[model samples]
Target chain A: MIRIENVSFKHRATPILSDISLDIPKGGVVALIGPNGAGKSTLLSLVARLQPLQAGVISVDGLPVDTTPSRDLAKVLAILRQDTTIASRLRVRELVGFGRFPHGRGRLTQEDDAIVDAAVAQFDLTDLSDRFIETLSGGQRQRALVAMAFAQDTDYLLLDEPLNNLDMYYARALMRSLRSVADANGKTVVIVLHDINQASAHADRIVAMKSGRIIADGTPGEILTPDMLDTVFGFRMRVETIEGKPFALHQL
Target chain B: MISAVSKPSLWTGLIAGLGLAVLFVLSLAVGVSPLPLNKVLSDPEAMQLLAVSRLPRTFAAVLCGAGLAIAGLIMQTLSRNRFVEPATAGTAQSAELGILLVTLLFPAAALWVKTLVAGGAALVGTSVFLATAHRLPPQQPFLVPLFGIVYGGVIGAVATFAAWQADLLQFLSVWTNGEFSGVLRGRYELLWIAALMVAVAWIVADRLTIMALGREASIGLGIDYARMMQIGLVIVSVITALAVVIVGMIPFVGLAVPNIVSRLMGDNVRGTLGWVAAGGAGLVLACDIAGRLLRYPYEIPVGTVMGVVGGAVFLWLLFRRGGHG
Candidate 1:
């Protein structure tokens, strides 16, 4: 479980995240949805300790994020941030192999190599494993980056805008893979998503944020209402149910 | 579907090794007072020149070449910008400043003392550049190198002004124009220290490779990014300072060599470092040899020759990359 209390973050003098508290229980998929500048990525960064906690406390599975050694924290949690640019020309396999660095400190044993292989296979990257990352299309690169995070083998995974450049088919494939992995391995996934219908179809719970604070948190069916969408996004959207799942039609 | 890029082949290593060997022989054989191969063993004067002058010059050239290349590789990786090197990033100019200051204040200081002071100044200079770079927004990739060039220019101006004020302008010119003409046995020993540092860099090549993955990814992989960066900065400063002190400023050997090696072998430091080192050493040796033969006895400085050749290569690299960065 991840816990946050009275968390607030400010960049320079402007507040990015206001005082907020939330608890994420273990072993399920939670989709974080929000409008632009709503602090969704900031919140994820704080939980992952990508950013320092300025005015609050965050703990991952009872270990305080600020005090815990990064190596120990890495074994328990992994995060894939948005807009990561790699300067080196790394092949897909080599990039995925870096996920085991926290465990092996660069020297990979047979077991570590097997884990990397599994991650490549899991992401359907076997064919593209030897291609340089610079040559990959946007969606292929996204898959490779996510595969790297998956190879970390952590209990808690936080993905910030992982679907940025992904097409619909790849996005659905990624969400389905995330769901299966969470279900089969008992891993906890916290994902920041933009498409509300995708979150409605795949996520076990939906977390809605507006103006640096969580406005609503519940199952997708509970939080996908037109009123909740209007409050969170500052606009009205139609909500409809199809085959027991609530989908938000915000395009119109 | 696995489209593996071509790895560095054994043939490449063999060829580079053979080339270095031939260049070493040429360096030894092509000086003003050339010693015949047979006479080198029999004549005391020939043997003395080989031991005291020729051998030291050859070794210094190789070590300086390899050291600066590795230093540049580390700088590029740490800065996450290919164009950032000792010459552009103000490290070499800061070292020149240290040499000038020590030359004035402690006129009797030994060579090692000057090298150490220069290295310390380089560390400070590089640290300032890094601090400023981190504060700037990362919008344009070329901005970092442009800032480095401007920063280096400021430091170079200060060094030049100080040299002029102290009446050491001649000394400054000699030190800034890199050459192998003065590498006597005792004078070139500091380059061995640079060789040692390059070995140390090789041992930590994996850490450096991880660093090239960018800050967030490095930290996410549980690397203490700041600590690794500090180590890289220290290595880069020390190598650049020592190279500048011993051979003057060998421009673009650092920049051109590593960039060329990465183009051929990819950027995994562990796999590519040896090639980069070899390429650097080979390039410097080739330039030094050309300098010796260009004017026969008078000789152009290796720095001048490298500037011409390396500048052309750098321009080609810029255009090859479509000038985006």
Candidate 2:
């Protein structure tokens, strides 16, 4: 379980995240949905300890995020951000291998190798394991990045907008893979998504934010109501239910 | 057929092997006074020069090159910028300032005293940059190095003013020129400290690599990003300061060598670091040899040649980059 309490963050005088509080229970996919400048990324960053908390407390599985040893935390949680601009020209296998760094440092054990290989296979990157990351397409690179995170074998995975730059086919494939990974592997996945339909179709819970605060949080059926959508998004949107899932028609 | 199918480790070993052989030959054969191969073996004068002057100097060059490259790697990792290096991070300038102050304050201070002062100053300078980076808004990582360069320029102006007042302006110029000609027996031993720094770099190379993938990724993995950065930057400053004191400022050996090696070997610091070191040593040796050969008796400083080569390559990279690869 991840708990955030009374978290308020500011850059200079401008408050980015104000008086935010939430508890994310263990397991399943939790989709964080918000438009641009909605503090979605900032919240994800705080949970990952990317930026220090200004006036709040966050804990992951009872361990304080700031106080815990990083090596211990690395074993439990891993994050993948949007701007993955690594300077090294590492191959897929090599990049994925780094997920085991907190465990083995540099010298890989047999278990480490097995884990990396399994992640490569899981991401359907087995054929491209030897290929350098720079040579891969956007979708392929996204898969490789996810594979790297998976190879860490963490229980909780926080991905910030993993769908960026991905084509429609790859994007759907990635969401499906995440859904399966959560179900089959029992890993808790928190993903920030721009596409609300994808979140509505796939997520177990949808967390909506606007202007750096959580406006709505519930199951897709509950949160996708027109009134809730209007409050969170500041506009009315038609909601359609198909096969027990609510889809918001906000584009038109 | 067996030889044609080369293993990855073998390829790495082969590159390292070739680098060592070339470095050895270059160290022995090229210098101000040429000794015949036969005479080099038997003559005491030739052997003494080879042992004391040439061999140590070559070793110093290799050590300094490798040390500076590793330092640059750590800086680039800590800063998370491709263009940033140890020299660009105000470390080299801080060391230069330390040297100037030591010389001006106490004219008869020991070499080690000056080196210690320089190393400490470099560490402080690097720490200041890290502290500022923590406080500042997250921008392009390269901007940290640019800001560092600006900070270094300001500090450099102070050093220049002091040097001019002390009538040691010529001495100050030598820091940027980076000559190894005076690196004989007693003076060059200080570079052994840089070799020790290489060992330190190896121990923490994994941490530095983890830190390079942005502070958030590292912190998410349960690593104290700031502490790791501080450690890496300190190591970078110490090695750079030691290198500066021993042979002045060898520009861009840090940036160019590591960048080239990572291109071929990939960017895993643990995997490519050996190649980075070997390639750095080979490049410095090759440049020094060219410097020796270009002018025959009156050699151009290796630092000047490195500056020219590094500047050209950097410009080429800037102009030719079509996309982030």
Candidate 3:
């Protein structure tokens, strides 16, 4: 479980996350949906301790993020941030193998090797594993990055906009993989997503954020209503339930 | 072969080691006198000549080259900019300052004592440069190197003032222009400590490799990023100071060799560290030999040779189409 209490972040004078508090339970995909500048990515970054927390407390799996040894925390949780520029010379296989670093410190044991190979196969990157990351298209690179995070084999995975740069086909494949992993592996996946339908179709819970605060939190059916969508995105959208899943027709 | 891209292949080591061995032999054999290798084993005088000047000079060149290359690669990793190096970041200049002060205050000091003081100065200077460089907006990656050049100039200015005031401009040149002509059995042995620093680098090679992926990723991978950074700066500064003390300052071996090795072996430090060291040794040995041959008995300083060659290669690295700067 991940816990946050009175978490408020300020970048200089402006508040990025204002007095936000939330608890994420174990073993399911929880999709955070919001418009631009809604503090979704900031919240994820804070939980991962990418930056120092200004005024709050955050804990992952009962370990306080601020004081826990990074090595210990890394074994339990993995995060993949968006817009990271990697060194071009690293191959996809090498980047994915880096996920095993926290365990072996770069000397891969046979078990770690098998895990890396499994991650590559799971992400459909078996053919491209030897290729340098720079040669991959944007979508393929995104998949490799996500694969690296999965290779970490942590109980909790935090993905910040993992769907960015991915086309619809790869995007759906990635979501389905996340869904299966959440179900079979019992992994806790907290993902920040833009496409409400992707969240609706795949996520067990939907979290809506607006102006640096969580405005609504419930199952996808409860959070995907037209009224709640308007409050979060500041616009009304038609909601359609298909096969027990509620998806918003926001593009129209 | 493609698998070699992500990790160090055995071939890379074999090829680089072979080239270094050949260069080492050439370095030992090529000199003013005819101390033939096969004859030196039997003749006492030839062995003396080989042991006294030839062996030390060759080892110094190799150690200096390997050490500076490792230093340069670490600097680039810590700063995340390929153009930045010890020479650009005031490390060499700070060591120069340390040398000038020690010379002024204690003219009779041992070379090792000078190295210790100079290493301290270099550590401080490099730490300041890195701390400031880290705070600057990283989006404009070029700013760090530009800032380093200016920072180095500022430290160089201080050394120049002290040298001029003491009327020791000639003495200063001894620290600024690197050569092995003055190197003897005892004089250049401090560079062996650089070998130790390189060993330490090998021990932490994986940590350094992860560090190149940026701070967040390094932390995520459970590396103590801040501690590794301090260790990296210490390694770079000490090797640089040792080289400055023994052979003066050689430029661009660090900057050029690591970048070239990265192109071949990719950025995995464990895979590339040996190649970078061997490539450094080979490059410096080649230039030193060229310097010996260029002017005949007069013998150009190795630093002078490096200035011309390193500058040309640096220009090529900068303006080359495709590939990183």
Candidate 4:
């Protein structure tokens, strides 16, 4: 379980996340949905210890995030930010192999190589594994980045806006892959998603936020109503039931 | 999925090694007083010239070239910009300033003492540049080299002004323009330390490669990002200081060699570090030989030749497709 208690953050005296506390259990997909500047990414960054904690205590499976060594934390949780740029001329497979650095400290063992191969295959990147990262399309590069994160083999994966720059086909494919990874591997996934329908279709739980505070938290069926959408997004959006799952039609 | 381990071809290594060997022989053979191979072996005075002047000068050229190129590679990786080098990043200028201060304060100081002081000043200057570079947005890659050039110009101007005021402009000129003419037995030993530092770089090549992935990803990979950056800065400073102190500032060796090596061999440091080092050494040796032959007994500085050659290559790099921002 990942427990966040009394978490608050500010950027140059302007509050970003205020008095936020939440509990995320292990082995389920949890999607964080919010409007622009709703502090969704900030919250995820804090949880991943990408940003230092100002007023909070966070623990992953009883290991305090603030005090835990980064190497130790890396073994339990992995994070993928939206704008992570790599400057090195790395091929897709080589990039994914870097995820095993914590385990091998730069020397990849046979087992580590197997894990990297599996990650590449799992992400449908086998054909593009030999290509340089700069040569790949945005969606393909995003997949490579995600594959790198997946090769970390951590218990909890935190992804912020992973769908950015992805086309519709890739977006759905990525969501389905995440869903399968969470279900089959028993890994806890906390994702910040901009598309409500993607979250509603694939996520086991939905948490809505507005202006740095959680407004609603429940299953998709309980939280995807038109009234909740307006409260969270500050606009009315119709919610429709599609094949027993709640889908938000916010495009109109 | 393909395996991640990519090694440089044996042929590339063989060719670089052979080229370096040929240049090394040429460096020893050509000079103001050309000593024939049989005469040097038989005549004590000829042997002395070869040992005291030619050998030391050759070693200095090779070591300085390799060290500066490796240092440039580290700086480029850490800064995430292709153009930032020891000369442009203010490190060499700062070391020159340190040399000037020591020369004025302790005119009788040993060569090692002066070199150490220069290294210290170079470290400070490089650290300041790294801190500033980190705070700036990395979206525009050109901004980094521009900042470096402006920053180095400021430092160089200050040094020049100080030298002029102290009536030491002539003394400063020797340290500003790189030449192997002054390299003798005891004068060029400081660059051996730079060679050792290059070995250190090879040992930590993987860490340096990971650092190029940017801060967050590096941290996520369980690397101590700040510590690695500090290590890189120290290596660059030491290498730059030694080069400046021993042979003056050789432009473009560090910047151009690594860029060319990476373009040809890829960016895997483990695979490319040796090639970069060899390429740097060969380029400098070639330039040093050219400088000697250009005027026969009265030679131009290697720094001038490199500036011309390296400047041309740098411009070509800028115009290359997908080369810059």
DockQ leader: 1
Q: Write the per-residue lDDT of candidate 1 for residues A1-252, one digit (tens) a residue.
A: 999999999999989899989999999999999999999999998888778899999999999999898888999999999988766888888889989988888899999999999989977899998888887888889899999999999999999989989888889989998999899999999999998888998899999998888889999999999988888988998888999999887888
Q: Ten-residue segment with the worst summed lDDT in candidate 3 chain A?
A: A82-91
Error of 1 at B290 (Å): 0.9
Ranking by DockQ: 1, 3, 4, 2
lDDT of every model, 2 decimals: 0.89, 0.81, 0.89, 0.89
lDDT of 3 by residue, A1-252 (tens): 999999999889988899988999999999999989999999998999888888999999899998998999889999999887786478888899999988887789999999999999988899998788877888888899899999999999999999999999989999999999999999999999999999999999999888899899999999999999999899899999999999899888
Number of backbone collisions per candidate: 0, 2, 0, 0
Per-residue lDDT of candidate 2, residues B67-153 (tens digit): 888887777677666666766768888899998888888879998999899999998887787677656555554566578778878
- CAPRI band for model 4: acceptable
Scanning candidate 1 chain B in windows of ten residues, the lowest lDDT window is: B1-10
TM-score of 3: 0.96
Question: What RMSD does each model have against the real structure?
Answer: 1.9, 3.7, 2.0, 2.4
Regarding TM-score, does 2 or 4 come out ahead?
A: 4
TM-score of chain B of each: 0.96, 0.92, 0.95, 0.95
Clashing pairs in 3: none
Query: Per-prediction interface RMSD?
Result: 2.6, 5.4, 3.0, 4.3
Q: In candidate 2, which residue pairs get closer than 3 Å at backbone N, Cα or C atoms, i.e. clash?
A: A70-B222, A70-B223
Better candidate number, 3 or 4, judged by lDDT = 3
What lDDT score is found at residue A26 in candidate 1? 95
Q: Model 4: clashing residue pairs?
A: none
* Per-residue lDDT over A1-252 for candidate 4, one digit per residue giving the tens place of the 0 to 100 score: 999998999999899999999999999899999999989999988887778899989999999887888888889999999877767778888889988888878899999999999989987899988787877878888999999999999999999999998898889988998999899999999999988889889999999998989889999999899898889888898888999999888888
Which candidate, 1 or 4, has the higher DockQ?
1
At residue B52, candidate 3 shows an lDDT of: 97
